[model samples]
Target chain A: MSGRLFHYNTLGTLMKGGFDGAFTFEEVLKNGGIGIGTVDHLDGELVILDHHGYRFDVTGQIHEVHLEDTTPYAAVIDFIPENKTTLNEKINKEILEEKMLGQFSSKNVFQAVKLHGRFSKIKCRSVQKQEKPYPDLVDVARDQAEFTAEDVTGTLVGIYTPALFGTISASGFHLHFISDDHHFGGHVLAFEINEPLITWQTIDTVEQKFPVGDPTFMKTDFDYSSVLEDIAEAE
Target chain B: MSGRLFHYNTLGTLMKGGFDGAFTFEEVLKNGGIGIGTVDHLDGELVILDHHGYRFDVTGQIHEVHLEDTTPYAAVIDFIPENKTTLNEKINKEILEEKMLGQFSSKNVFQAVKLHGRFSKIKCRSVQKQEKPYPDLVDVARDQAEFTAEDVTGTLVGIYTPALFGTISASGFHLHFISDDHHFGGHVLAFEINEPLITWQTIDTVEQKFPVGDPTFMKTDFDYSSVLEDIAEAE
Candidate 1:
């Protein structure tokens, strides 16, 4: 659940100097559209994921401009366990895995790909109101009959960086996988959720570190190779 | 030589989740060591490459350090062409090619490896520097033709951003490729020459971009794929 997905522009060599052929860092700002798709369990409640659209420099003859493909994270579903693992325990683990992997999401958008159901593809709109707009995932998991939040007390689900959202802890996201099946799938649902990708100057909040002893953490001394390898091996 | 050298500890099985006999991120940081070699051709007189001294964490251990490796950039005597190509132009092209390859140099200080001559196996310093006493590097490439300060424009060799240094620029480097020789079997010499990597926090710099008015400049509003193919074919 708390896992990451790295999406390198596979279609790079076919382009200009590569992925950003004519789209230099400067050009990207002038005319680029980040493509994003989200299936919100809740209607219009914070678009669980939002791609702060792309920019364009000039208009075409018909006044139409093409937006760049900019979706950062894609929901990749691997087979989920079919056995009867306690609902809460399964949910917590799902959240945890997704959060761990979410760290690898684009630095600009602290987005985490959430997984809902033990099935093939996740549909766009099938979640409850209580879980809308960033669910109270931790609190909800506490009510499950077979599991408790204590299972992941010190484990890190996400990291917090102050530079991203001003004084508001913007970047790092933690995973809180919760399980529930009877409501929708009847096949225990898994939620991999985390903080939205916050950008600089866009939000009024300042960056802040996560609470002490969180597993999803980043520090100057922390070596990144091991983490990279861990994620690499999982894939 | 600006190229870096790195090695793995076990060479295998580090990526197997590292949880149950898997290599964990915590272990990698504890043992990783990185060495940076700076070259000389990129330096200018009175233009010191501001190697910010090593920085430490609260525990009083060196968390990060910087160093320099200097080598010559002159072409191998045998490789010097009777043809009209300039040595400077050839060296510049090779260096640019390496950058395009995305070759960044960073080996963990704890798990440090010995520095070798540019791209060759020739070792430079005897004792590998430790990570605890973080230190900055100053490389010097000697015995070459002299040039006036005006002739010594700094090239953007590298860019670095650490929590402490913020954003720093590097220049000191000389990349020269040599053909085989009877005496010292010539391999690629990422040789360091007399130059220094400098910082960007300054005023009155000489760096300039090619203007759009230049006849060589080309602009187009097309897909990146088409443009890239055309450039490659033109070259």
Candidate 2:
């Protein structure tokens, strides 16, 4: 089976304040065709679909990600949808998540999900670029920019991480949105979907790549003691 | 660099009492040349060297692992030593770990280590085969068999996992030993190496595989809340 999820760096390292980006979009795309992440200095939310990367800046403007743009953390999968279903009724995030969980054969395996349709309302948030000596993520998130749109057509690109790997990646659903017109997109906070088409695949293997030689990543003493709590607060 | 580590299943799942093995040695050997793991039912300690798999049963008797033998948890790599050194002086586990850490370019990346030489004294342990209704690792470990030997020649097969991925795998040095004669071996508890040749490589990528359809693995609610503490106490 070609179900493999590729991720660079860890959420714990990002939460610990290591914001320098060493892996470029050029390299990240070679591993998978669809994914989500943040750009250099945590500049904005990143969304990858059809092997192309896009960045939703803090001002809620969408930009085609440059090949050379770097990222501190990201997860991508060469998605091959094993199951497809359509939701005819309006559904919220919590209800959708429960429905998705019910369809999963095992909650322990990672999953790649795609939701394409019109949303009655969707809320997103993106962080601004940071200066050197970056503050921890919880502090950076305090000043994040929030954006809300009504009746927008978009695709929610997401990865479902099991709780056992909460530190490496955000546990549960971590999704990013990119509208059809490519004018608006950011990290998805909450949404109400109407008759959306959902496609998902179980990821049997997770290939985690670390920032081996980056000076900032190497020097940083990553402490994950309160990482789960910090992630809950930050995201 | 072919510095990729392949592992089957998560330590958290094993600790949560999911003990039935679904992946076989035949499947595991295809991923790497050398590694360490446990056989079916958590029956014994397993060590792989030069592409050959061996099992150290609870009775301290070494057996050539059959190709069809299954494993619940294991980590393997196509080892190409990036650096090698000889320790002429006697060194204990703590001192050796310190020396190894100094040579590592990044503590965040996983590492594969091999030590071959004579040991003045070595202590090891292995668990007996468990029956149905498997108990948690902390409870099973209490009945583990301990083995000690003096002035023995052997190879210490080990993997170094970072603290950030502690729940997925055991953090720090997790080593298993096998004598040259293939007579004595088990999970290494403590050892005093004398003039041993040490070789290691940085694992930039870790490919983690899950037991997707296994009934027990699917049903078990893996709780990693106290996993780190439990690992510390069990080991």
Candidate 3:
């Protein structure tokens, strides 16, 4: 066939989720016209037979097959297998590192803030914890009290909030901030695991309601303008 | 937590070209809160914590877990685990059906054509002898022939092109007729698979090359206006 064939590990995981396991090679071959073969002897390799009688073996991949209608225009998407090496490599770690790095503050910001206690104990939680641990208020206040004379207009209130997920391994320190008394006012902010004072937002609270699942009786005041780009998953 | 998990097995052949496995569960938790107790686990089961924090175990007969990504998001997608299932379920069977169903005749058009003695025996090395036994020529012809009037527009020539696997599965067939005998005729006639008769110019001659590495390049010079809506697969 003149087309391509894609082989995807039926057992492979995906971002969407996992598989239910209701498919087989024999079932795949029920369709007439395409050839069926084995890849790595997996028992269900798809053999696409194009109009030109060329065969492509697609063992584990997703493929697009298009057949045009031209004399001598015989083509098929027999095999469009992808190289596995690229997939195995992790996504750019530097991107995550840079993001985390930007969330931290230099030795200068810490030197500038004055805390109530000289020593404050920090305890991280396990995945199995009941309630998510919150950052200590006294320490947060110190981190939130930074004042930079060099940058004339920046304020310290922009660096503290309740939405921060704490610091993660290899990533920098994480912090969150909310603006003023606007309960749902400014977008929730985040900072790196080790990098304090550098604020970012993972998600923006767009709408709010008194009770969950009561769509009809709800209150929607969160504008979500500040962190729109951060929470834009699709579109 | 409120959403249910469903699983089903293919009894006989369910030949709709694809299957969806949906499972459901009752009110284990409500409104993103924890609920239900620990249940004994088993192999090959999928556990998902819903918005309400109720756990669901989804199991399948033939498929297995491939991958899983969970956020506090609303819905979930379980991709088929095995290569054959993903290929057939997600790619091959689905795309093939879409392409064929979109453009080709709903009812096999070969049934309408009056063929001479034992046209079924007219086998070529281009097609797979094992997959398709002779009698299905009606479906084959229907998938490959263009509609033509009995009037003497020109000569009818049958062209045989091999698919990628040295089979007739993805090949194209066309018939051409010349109004005036000339090496470079401006206007002539041609018919192809799933197409009607049409006049063409010199450049429109059935001599176009396959685009890049496209294996399924059977472009024909017949009228596709009627079936264009039914056969377009870009979506």
Candidate 4:
């Protein structure tokens, strides 16, 4: 009923080490869409908008994503908010999620979420390129590096997928951050809002494209239960 | 490691009525593998083996599936037994699952199960094709036709997926049925097994192929929470 959105693949597949890029950044950014995902090779956190890709790596560095590059997973939609709301109240992540959920009519629809404001303190994390004989995702959480930024001004680009759709997407809000100054950002873990909330929404119509070319994604037969747990622990 | 499993699409997608078959019945049985799924248009239950696809319609009629027929969802792997054990005790479905799960080293991997024996009673259900704009899956659960066979001798073909993979796959066991005489079969709901049980297993290396051509599957954007509940209720 609202505007459109696109999803590339299931979160469960990505969490299971299906990390080869299935689509290019240019392909993902057609029509100037905004979204979040990990870069190919599981290198870092990715935020796409303004016809550019910003990568927040684990080494405390930000890099310009090449247009020719690719991604294994991403959800993007042309930014045309069908609904708008304002909540000028201080809140935490859980509270913010609840507030956004209040605006949704059903649990099955995907909602594109954008919040522009200042945060008290934001904590985020990213993982590096995993070497072969990749350990279980739970085992890799031990190595994830968490970054912190205090009094940060950023636009949290996120999507809210219902918990029942937890396989390829997260059960709830999944936001990736990019600061105003483009200095610090990562996969959002914890954050507190200041005030003057600005929110936007659009429904996503996703097309999941599998990576049949990658032998690993095509051939790996291992269990992802631990990986799911690892993702939960990291979250 | 011994063979491969072909997964047409996610169970989540199937519940959404993306019932157009993606692969042919003969393709699904190239190796004479066994599995469970729904026919195109959600017509009824489908169980394949010995290069023959069996259809169990809602009217309790059994038909031989043409090789050219396709399925929206199915998981099939070459039947190569990696392990075998005798289960010579009378037990209910729950008890049998618990006993077999104990043999697995982990909960994340797929477990293909086969059991041959007499059952005091078996209950199964098959859904008819839904009209569009298709109703929500939860709304249609009230209409599923439940069928029961008493003192039935049949073989149960099943797959056990991890709870973590709950979104696109059943979190636990999903079984389909075929009587010893090839007369009765459908999606298994419940059954009580007699003595001299038979079981088979082989790890499933599954590759999910999304339906890229189905515009509905590619474009639908909505939450599946109620649908998941509907599946639970039906199961």
Candidate 5:
């Protein structure tokens, strides 16, 4: 049987400014080989590739994530790709998304995708660590640091969620990038791919684990109606 | 560790008239001891208590569900109750719901509930088997057989889903009843409890398994935006 996509907490909790980390990196890696998320206090961008976790800080510095580091939200899978294809032609994000959509047998299921190759240009963003009494995600996003890297070879780990689950997780594609040199990386805002090898797995099963014992998670009344709008603004 | 709530398919798929059964009841029971669902061809109301599956057909006949019986949608759990209480006073469905809500530590997580005791009255409905070209659930529900039993003892099996996951499962409470004598049962529409024992579990983890290999499930494009409205109209 294929391994399920393991999800920690939820975007809904994060949107409500519940950014404290509850699950450790070591525990997250035990569930999957690759994933993307943010560290404690909404610190920077997290990318897990080849079973190694890396953090891309707001100051454009990359650091190897410690096993004890914690995350507020993450979606990871064992990543046994059912389909593998090479895209020799140059393509932008829109074209790549269209191709991926074409490959899906069902548009309503979760999908895990990985792309490894050269990229002519990749624009990314990372958030600075926040202090107590955290503001909502939309507010924190306003001060996000944006950067661009040109002519970088890297791997992009992406998770696609159907529209039905938009509130629980980010709707559509959420991708993070990390260069082979372990220097350039962040949440992918836009990218131009060049001859990348793409591997994707159609995820039919998902294990969503919530921070039940966390006081913040247990006390707050999450307003899901505004979640999609908040995620749109924050992302 | 608490067992995760196991869910099969989505309410969105059923709303779109995809009624073919995919997972076997035997497979569903392996993941949980108690649950609620419908049998193949949208046959009738299905209830599983004490690891035994039973069907309340439209003709007011209850039958033992065989191992080979299939299901298109189901939500089941190993049912380890975290809290147990008894309501000795008479209470209607609305009041019972309010009390259950009071027991919830968080309004955003899934919950499993079981009620066993005497009841003054119970109003319920069961759908007849459908043909190949299955009509949408709303239409099917319109022609459902409604029945009521007064002064009886039975069990009410229920599952509570948060608003965030409304499209995946029923938003609020979805309950089914089965008399202790096995002579009466159906999807509960209204009920009056008399001194019942209530046991509920706060669900922090969920395992959602989709029918990836089913042709109908793979071909249908689920419209989740109107699922809430459809579910409201249907049930």
Candidate 6:
């Protein structure tokens, strides 16, 4: 089966102010897809699937975003899983990347990556929204709150883009987490898994959807050099 | 009002056997959008507006694709005209681009471009379906059928993307022409407008939907560099 990855905005433009989103949260979910993104203006981390959107703020407080709410950046795909491979050996994050990328012939297209089962350990972060006269993405990232969870049973939802994607899409493995119990999760910073169930589908196509609310997006002289550097450092 | 420029597939990918499409013709028209694409496997050209899809083939024969038909690549956006201006002076293609781009605050985002009225001259092209052993896009383009219409009353449906988009999108300007009588149209190759009615809207968001076919897409070594080159050269 083929897949399409729907991205709300490019990471580069969002650095300037794409955070002021154009569509409502409900409108985005009507497609009934799965993926990850941040709330408008970087207020929190978001995880969506099956028409429900969960937001975990910098304080780690889990809140369900209403349909009327908007997001600065978001992504989704009508996921129909075609694989269920259970790894037999323990794996670290780096090795996991190697094993997965090795399966694909190329690294340029989008990949729908999902992992189920318990994690030995995981580290994640979430950012708080900035006030008017918003700061650069790097600055916002500098103050992002970090959290850690151990021996948690949950699922990981994310997308993998080619490194060349750079600012348009977040490069490398970008993921968000939500526990099975629906108690803990956020943007993934680090993780360790032992023989977890892995399911991935390479997306044949993608749509880069931009936000409509940011008026200053076009006028700003965003130095992408620094913006990209910050994104890489954070990753 | 806000607009979105929906694209079917990346220009680069379409060059490498992306002809196998996923969504049905009616599904792509549900958004009440206007744009263009090709039938699955490059069978015919497509133009959609007002919940209707118009198909034109290499023979310049116009037909309507059934709802069950699929498109390898297609794009559309809810057309809510935010600007309408009548150009009373004789104009060429270059000056039209100048006038349209000049009205927008920035050329970094997608713009839904539509020109209505009688065209002094217009040239277009369309390709036929390939056999089992599908060749490269540039090869298909080599044998594309070309058509030109003079003094036709119709509308031009298209979009202008940022140059940085390169292969991810066809940068500069991309358009398709369909006569008012629905008897003439194809992928726009060249055109000259004299005192036509022009309308444009800055798309606030976009969603790229992929067709649910082609199993070997992820495993194929698509030469994006060449594919991109072909798109750029053709554009």
Clashes of 4: 11
Over B5-95, each residue of candidate 6 has an lDDT whose tens digit, in order, gives: 7666566667776777666877778764688777877776788866678878878899888889877777778788898887778887777
Order the candidates by TM-score, highest first — what do you get? 2, 5, 6, 4, 1, 3
Instruction: Please give, for residues B1-235, the per-residue lDDT of candidate 3 as tens digits.
Output: 0121111111000011111121122311222111111111111112222222222222112121222321111111121111111111222212423443233221111000100111111111111111211222222222331222222222211121111101111122221222111111110122122122211111001111112221111121212222212211100
* Per-residue accuracy of model 4 over B181-211 as CA lDDT, tens digit each: 8777788878887674556664534544455
Compared with the real two-chain complex, what DockQ does model 1 have? 0.03
Clashing pairs in 6: A8-A209, A40-A72, A207-B208, B22-B211, B22-B212
Evaluate fnat for each of the predicted models and list the values in order: 0.00, 0.77, 0.00, 0.10, 0.70, 0.43
lDDT of each: 0.20, 0.87, 0.18, 0.71, 0.86, 0.75
Using DockQ as the yardstick, the better of models 4 and 6 is: 6
The C-alpha stretches of model 1 lying farther than 4 A from their native spots are: A1-114, A117-235, B1-235
How big is the positional error of residue B108 in model 4, measured in Å on the Cα after superposition?
1.4
Count of backbone clashes, every candidate in sequence? 73, 0, 98, 11, 0, 5
DockQ of each: 0.03, 0.71, 0.01, 0.09, 0.66, 0.27
Please name the candidate that would achieve the greatest DockQ relative to the true structure. 2
Candidate 2 is scored at a TM of: 0.97
RMSD of 1: 21.6
Question: What's the iRMSD of model 2?
Answer: 1.7
- Model 4 over residues A100-187: C-alpha lDDT tens digits? 7776544455677777778888988887876665554445556888999999898888888655456557767889888989998988
Score candidate 3 by TM-score against the native. Answer: 0.15
- Score candidate 1 by lDDT: 0.20
**Candidate number that wins on TM-score, 3 or 5:** 5
Better of 1 and 2 by TM-score: 2
The segments of candidate 4 whose C-alpha lies over 4 angstroms from its true place after superposition are A1-165, A168-235, B1-3, B202-204
